[model samples]
Target: MAGEEFEYEYLYKALAKYANEHQYPLAQQAYEGAGAAEKIHAAILKEAANVKTYEGTTVYVCPICGYVMAGDSIPERCPVCGGPERQYEKF
Candidate 1:
C-alpha cells in the first residue's frame, strides 16, 4: 500500500513536470492514473486548510509578476513588475 502511494506521488510529480513542459496528453494520462483533477484539487484544498487566515492583514499577489504583498492597502507599485495597485489580487 505504501509503495502504491509512493508510485502515485511519483506520478503526481511527473504529471506536473509534463504539464509544465506542455505535454498535456502525457500529463493527463499520469494525472488520470493518479486520480485525476480531484486529486489535485484535494491536495490544493488540504494545503490551503493549513494556512492561517488573517482578517486584519490582507494578502495580495501582483497579477503581472506574481509579487506578493501583505498590507491593508494596495502598494503604489508591484516590486517585481512595477504594476499598479489595480493589478494586484487580494486573498
Candidate 2:
C-alpha cells in the first residue's frame, strides 16, 4: 500500500506539473492536493506496516482531490483541498 501510494504520489505530482504548464489551474490544484495526501499516506502506511491486527478502522476518500484517510475516523474536511465531510466517500 505504501508503494502504491508513493507511485500515485509521483504520478499526481507529475500531473500537477503538466496541468500547471498547460494552464489548467483546477486540474493542477486537484493533482497537487492528491499528491500531498499520497505522500502523507505513504508515511501512514509505513507506520501501519508492522501492525498485524485490525479493528473498526474507517476509510474516507475526498472525491474532489483523491485524498485518502484511514483510521478510526476521518476529519471534518480534507486538509489538502478542504473537501467537506458530506463530500467524502466512506468505506
Candidate 3:
C-alpha cells in the first residue's frame, strides 16, 4: 500500500506537470482541495509537492467489493471477498 501510494504520488506529479504544461487552470485548481473535492484535491496537491508521507494517504479501494486496502500493496486475496489483486483500484 505504501509503495502504491508512492506510485500514485508519481502519477499525481505527472498529472500536475501535464496540468501545468497545458495551462489547465481547472486542473491546477482541481489540485487545490475545496468542499466535497477536498480529499481528491489534496491527493493531487501532495503529488505536485512530491509528498512522501502516507499519514494522510487515502487507501486503495477494491472494485470487486467495498473493501479498502490500506498500508501498501494489495493483499494476495481480499479478506472480505477473496478477490485477487486485480480487484483493487487506486483512489
Query: What lDDT would each prediction earn against the true structure?
Result: 0.59, 0.80, 0.55
The number of the candidate with the highest lDDT is 2
Q: What does candidate 3 score on TM?
A: 0.35
Ranking by TM-score: 2, 1, 3
Candidate 3, run of 10 with poorest lDDT: 32-41
lDDT of 2 by residue, 1-91 (tens): 8575866657888898999999999999878877787787776677678777556777788888777788866789889988798998887
Error of 3 at 7 (Å): 33
Better of 1 and 3 by TM-score: 1
Tens digit of per-residue lDDT, candidate 3, span 15-87: 6567878999677444421221333434555565685665755577656544565556557876545668776
Stretches off by above 4 angstroms in model 2 are: 5-9, 56-58, 71-73, 87-91
Score residue 13 of candidate 3 by CA lDDT: 56
TM-score winner: 2
In Å, residue 3's CA in model 1 sits off its true spot by 25
Q: Please give the TM-score that candidate 2 achieves against the real structure.
A: 0.65
Q: What is the C-alpha RMSD of each candidate to the true structure, in Å?
A: 9.6, 2.9, 12.4
TM-score of each: 0.39, 0.65, 0.35
